[model samples]
Target: MKKSYCPIDTFINVIKGKRKSTIILHLFQGNKRYNELVKLIPDISERMMSKQLKELETDNLINREVFPEVPPRVEYSLTDLGKEIHPYLKGMFKGGIIFENKIDSEEN
Candidate 1:
């Protein structure tokens, strides 16, 4: 199917959305259960968080594991592609601050 987006644009779109980048950031630190992510990014609604996670999984950036247990255990971690892509996350990490603070600005 011909997409209405450039290949690069399509690639960026997969990661640029509601909260996909933030969720990936949390996972980059280490593997986490779904609840841990919710706690880390409190502003995100549960529905939104789940949706973002699924998108990342589809993009091959994350791996979701489900364990069969009485309480139903589930965990999420980054895939090899995630490690490759994490460097880009830094752009989001240091966004405004990178240019917002002037080199000569002196503020305590």
Candidate 2:
């Protein structure tokens, strides 16, 4: 695979998908089951959610635990690295809100 030269590019690559940051933000609240995450993010399809979760797992930002049960329950939580980046992700979320409000005000 081609390597990214800049640290920012590398970081961005991990969270590039539309739902990645949203997933992280939700996990920041606490560990969640697959269905719970799907419920929290209304617009995302199950297939896309699975894809993003797999990518996040590959990046070491989230942990997936499979329970030994008849139904095979699965839960995801943030890793230490993911916890560390929570503030930055939160900041981006706030900035997005500000940006949207600014644009709305400008249109009036």
Cα TM-score per model: 0.81, 0.93
What lDDT would each prediction earn against the true structure?
Answer: 0.83, 0.91
Q: Which stretches of candidate 2 lie over 4 Å from their true place?
A: 1-3
lDDT per residue for candidate 2 within 45-64, as digits (tens), equals: 99999999998998889999
Q: Report how far residue 64 has shifted in candidate 1, in Å.
A: 0.5
Pairs that collide in candidate 1 are none
Clashing pairs in 2: none
Tens-digit lDDT track of model 1 for 1-108: 124468867667778868787888888999999999999999989999898888889888999999999899899999998878788787757874765675437553
What lDDT is reached at residue 48 by model 2? 94
Report the lDDT of model 2 for residue 11.
75
- The stretch of ten residues in a row with the least summed lDDT in candidate 1 is 99-108
